[model samples]
Target: MSACSVFDRIFMAGLVEMNLSFASKYGAKALGR
Candidate 1:
């Protein structure tokens, strides 16, 4: 594949990971309360 495609995949992965982290952090706090 191309470099751009590789970068996009990495970017998307980071984005998903960040979202999951944010969601889990907030979700746990919300549930705890």
Candidate 2:
């Protein structure tokens, strides 16, 4: 139970980092264009 929650939090942190990086890349590209 507790271990599953810990895994879930780590997974969500990775997901958030991915999303932020993706958005940042697209935003920079859009500005460059």
Candidate 3:
């Protein structure tokens, strides 16, 4: 595997984690309404 591929994988994983956290936060706010 190349360095670029490794970097891409890490970037994607970070995005996924960010999305999950954001979604959970939004969901909690919606439920609170």
Alpha-carbon TM-score of each model against the true structure: 0.87, 0.82, 0.90
What would the per-residue lDDT of candidate 3 be over residues 1-33, giving only the tens digit for each residue? 999999999999999999999999999999994
User: Which parts of model 2 have CA positions greater than 4 angstroms off?
Assistant: none
Instruction: Tell me which residue pairs clash in candidate 1.
Output: none
Pairs that collide in candidate 3 are none
Candidate 3, superposed: residue stretches over 4 Å from native: none
Candidate 3 Cα RMSD (Å)? 1.3
lDDT of 2: 0.96
Across 1-33, the per-residue lDDT of candidate 2 in tens digits comes to 699999999999999999999999999999995
lDDT of 3: 0.97
lDDT of 3 at 7: 100
Which 10-residue span in candidate 3 carries the lowest summed lDDT? 24-33
All candidates' lDDT scores? 0.98, 0.96, 0.97
